[model samples]
Target chain A: MSVSGAVSEIVAERWVERTLAAYPAEILPFLSGEHDRFRNPVGQVIQESLTTLARELLGAMDNRATAPAIDALVRMRAVQDFSPSAALRFIFDLRPVIAEVCGEVTPQLESRIDELALMAFDRYLACREQIASLREKELRVRALSPAR
Target chain B: MPETLVQIEQKAPRGDWRDPHVEFRKGSICYSAAAKNLGALSLPNPRAWQPMDADWKLPPDWKRIVLDGMKERLKKYRSFRLFMDICVRCGACADKCHFYLGSADPKNMPVVRAELMRSIYRRYFTLTGRLFGSLAGGRELTEDVIKEWFYYFYQCTECRRCSVFCPYGIDTAEITMMGRELLNLIGCNTNWVLEPAANCFRTGNHLGIQPHGFKDSIDFAAEEASEITGLDIEVPINRKGAEVLFVMPSADYFGTPHYYTLLGYLMLFREIGLDYTVSAYASEGGNFGLFSSHEMMKRLNAKIYDEARRLRVKWILGGECGHMWRVLHQYMDTMNGPADFLEVPVSPITGTVFENARSTRAVHICEFTADLIHHGTLKLDPRRNDHWIATYHDSCNPARAMGLLEEPRTILKSVCRNFHEMPENTIREQTFCCGSGAGLGTDENLEMRLRGGFPRANAVKYVKEKHGVNLLTCICAIDKATLPTLLEYWVPGVEVAGVHELLGNALVMTGEKERVADLRGELFAPEAHSVGSASEASHA
Candidate 1:
């Protein structure tokens, strides 16, 4: 179930392809083809680096490693001002890509990967909700302070 | 020109007196009699009220004009675009609205309130709306819808309390501003709001009460202040190079009870020996009616920066008014900027800097007083305010909107011996409007006034019935004018006064002995503050 370096690039490239495919025909012309020309390669490198960091950070259980990786991913999206709904869209877009790229693997491996994706999405959602709550609290404190 | 002016004056009715008591209330106290008889109050002269002319239609291309203007204003901001785009229509903000809570009306729902502008935004700007039309909840703009927009948009106090609970962080105040901007593009503005804005544009004050009237009002207030405190307080006006410019709403200049708070400011400034001057030109700081439109708001506020420059004041002290403070705190800096001549005000008495200041180094009157009290420069006899159970109504501007909740309370607690807060939800950011704020405080809108004022009046009534609270204290000038009218309608016996009025009553200064008779009469009843022993008092 571990995504090696070659497997990570294969997964990311499939994600980008699937995301570009989901747009309606009218919006196809507006799609950037790449997320951002300058950021895409660097972003993929950082995302993979963080996945390794999450594995090292979590140390023992593979299920536990999945949660930390998803948490880190959610934190990254929040720093970019991505809402939970938008985060969900990004995850959903990656699904068809995962199926297409990982289809030739064993059925058992495919089910394990699907389970990991679902678990990661749930953890990402929980992190997004936590971030949103913190943001709301911060806003309240700023509003209640004398010097708003 | 003179002939036309004379003709217009002749056509305008000369003070129609329907009921002398009503006339007395409006003319002297500025208490809108409409607030008293909420459901049945009639216009002062029905003849004077006319529907818009049949030919008065918006230009055929009004939408293009408004959208172009909005695009130009919003071109630089990506966040504003996102804010406009991301509303999920969950009804959390509906019950949280003070107006909706009071009125129980479906249209007053915050989502619907915001949708007045949002629908228009979608219709004109979004691809979904351009494709789907009414199915996408986009409707064509018509005169009727515009009128409804005006009615509900003006109903909002722009208090921003609803934004606190909004799941999307959607600020209804921003939507209200956009609504006002669009309304202004078509010239469908109220005479009360537009005329005052026009007056402020031309004469630097909303009332258009000329320099002589300004002087007269100030001198009269100073005389009253002198009568209360034995000091001959002089309220200097338009004096160049003054250290501070005291800008207040025009209502404070002419409105009763509000005039008392103005006098309190005068006495405190004189007592502390601060170099300040009132601007004869820019007399009003609050534009409650500007809740309707940004153009009207900008027109009214245009004088503030210019007047400060003309007077060469180092700092401006905003009077205790609700919406005015909201406008000043929220948009003054953004709308009128680079006021490099001004510095954030350091209290002359305390030497403490006001850290929460925005745009042109303005300070609220209560913040100024709290600082003065902190410095120990303001002589206090807190016992003077002990006769009545006092509760503070945190005006919406200073509370949830601007976060100026504590400074006023600090001053009140220090000055008043017995100070209490109303229920928890009824104070600080959750505080209710005095029903008459955001220009609905006028006599013309009786039903709307009752709906808006009900929550605030009910809260004050609850405290009064339960705790024997007789007086409601707030810092805003509009609160003084409007709360009294509302209390008369709902609570019947409760009195509302400015926080500074209580401070003035408690102030102990040089020649305090000579003013004891006047102070005792106003501050305490004969039975409450008898000087003689109990047996001697009984005999007397």
Candidate 2:
């Protein structure tokens, strides 16, 4: 792997660690155990899901699966009443975290992360659109049926 | 000295950790349902906003509306009254909760979940609570508290597993239902559930499949069933005077894994030549309203009996679904009818009577099929499913609510050779929710679903490692949709399927050709069969 690719891996792990650190430290360890069933296991599931998305996002891989993963993360964020800045910031928040980890990086990685932020914004908007459309469905489609 | 059970258990991942003080966080909270869906239901005080919004725009009379709603519900449901009035806080139900077990959130505990409402019930209804206030575990109903109601209530799947261990039989499902109903009075309802209920009310199915579209789906399933069996079988749609009116979850007709289960029903009905007719008007057995309010549940459920009487069917045969049975078995007769117009359901082919469902007079498909298998009505080839080591997931509603456990397993044992149960605690009445039932199965709530579904998945992982069990057979439509993603994310490659789907795969339909693939659409080629069997055996 290229030096930057290796750097991305280190930064990605650091970023996931940093993002998880944002929550209470007490609950952080349970994040990866898939079999940890309980009430409101949502906390751990979100951490693990975001961790995967962060790693895959920072690596800047062109895998198609990443799109849905990104969409899912944003849907979770957008549905909550977070400010647009706070909701989308997790993707862009990688910049400072990555910089602090890598010490120094080329503009290519930086620009790529910026592009991902834009994609994250678009995906977030799409989730909002879905919510809006579903809400409107009751009124607009009462007479005419919408195809599943 | 021998190592004790605790020491041995401590050597691995501990399942019994207890945090004495559990705190709440925004982490696992669900997004607020949009205002329009609530307005569509004509609920009072609807407004557009998110759960995190600073202002919820409550009507001036919101408090009165809620208190009045509570007053009315208490009178209507004796269980609600008894549950509310009699709770000694035994703490027996705390660890028993899958959500509390999975997340360690105290509020997720059944007692704590009820306390959220019971505290309010105390604040207004009780003498000591009103005087002493917080000291008496009572609090005034406020906006933040309303948000808490939405968060915790929607968080619950209303599985009712906690009710079993409770000394008072305090059903949290009833509390959760009442919480949701109270929320609905104020126009707080989730769109994922409201949309499906509305669709079912209008189109007779959750997916909103109109009569023609419903016919198209049945036609397609018939074609595919023929492709597998080489027997062209046409399913009846909306024909009167049919002996039985078959009802099913609409997801079976539309969703991928679920559609395969639909194919199973088609094949099973054909094999017995059952005198049944599918109705366009009462097509849905899965009631999304069960996730919402009682009135909505009744409105959505009334169509089934109405269509049955119109079609002149003597009895009803419900398909493989979890919560659908909860309604049909427990609530249907009370909410919908005397059903005196219809006769007791008896299998014409097997000569077996469903005495358990004598009052409701509706037979679960598993019970019906199990009876047929016992009577040797059809030849089942177990080797056809030699590749899968299956474990049965007793979905929460059917197992706990109605006790329809052994019927599915009996059918599975008859059809599939390699069947195992998950660890005893996780099966039967103690089953975990798919994490996304009761209307929280939307994309937005994916994180919550994954976590809530983790305990069940964790138990599945245990079996997968221990027994090499690859197939997780369940009989819930919500499980069909949610478990696939939940299991795939947590324990990949272990899949979900309905019991009927497996039976369809194993059934040697008369005059049928060699099966090319199982119901999952995986190739069952002769060459792959030996290799698959060898590998699957090694897994066991």
Candidate 1 lDDT, A15-70, residue by residue in tens: 54443333223223323332331112213323443445323322342655555555
Model 1, position A75: C-alpha lDDT score: 40
Candidate 2 — which residues are off by over 4 angstroms? A1-148, B1-36, B525-540
Candidate 1 scores an iRMS of 26.3
Question: Least accurate stretch of 10 residues (summed lDDT) in model 2 chain A?
Answer: A137-146
lDDT values, one for every candidate: 0.62, 0.75
Per-model TM-score, in order, reads 0.67, 0.76
lDDT tens readout by residue for model 2, A100-121 = 9767555976776777787888
The TM-score that candidate 1 achieves is 0.67
Q: What is the interface RMSD of candidate 2, in Å?
A: 12.3
lDDT string for model 2 (B365-476, tens) is 8888888887777677666677889999998888888888888988888778888888777889878777878887765566566557777887787789889999999999
C-alpha lDDT (0 to 100) for residue B524 of candidate 2: 56
